[model samples]
Target: MGIFGFFILAAAGYFLYRNYFTTNTYETKDERYNAARAQRQKELDGLLDKINRRGMSSLSERERQRLDELSGK
Candidate 1:
């Protein structure tokens, strides 16, 4: 092969090696976060159910605190 062809092949090989070895670790973390979010949403849904049945005023102080803690606000 000519010098140019040899360099082209070398670059291609290097790119292939990099592409093969790169880690995609974010997907696993994103899945965990999605699961936690879904669980939190379910908990909030339950709380809303309580509110619907018992009225918002019926929420105890502890329940309000718990809601605030979960909401981080």
Candidate 2:
């Protein structure tokens, strides 16, 4: 029973290490930058659309700050 429990713990540790510590080897720096830029653009577009539908006053302070940050203010 002791050896069985040790093996179980070792397997769980290895699974956690593999999931959290391992980095993706296929993603290059440029790829990561492009992905981030695209995501920012998507968020900016959504915020702009919301403003058009409702109004600037509908945005929360955090959302306004995020919009400014994404827009490079």
Model 1: clashing residue pairs? none
For model 1, state the Cα shift of residue 15 in Å.
40
Cand. 2 Cα-lDDT: 0.93
Off by over 4 Å in 1: 1-27
Best by TM-score: 2
lDDT of 1 by residue, 22-52 (tens): 7554568889999999999888888878989
Worst 10 residues of 1 by lDDT: 18-27
Tens-digit per-residue lDDT, 3-51, candidate 2? 9999999999999889878955688999999999999999999999999
The residue ranges of model 2 lying beyond 4 angstroms of the native Cα positions read 1-25
lDDT of 1 at 9: 100
lDDT of candidate 1 at residue 17, scale 0 to 100: 78
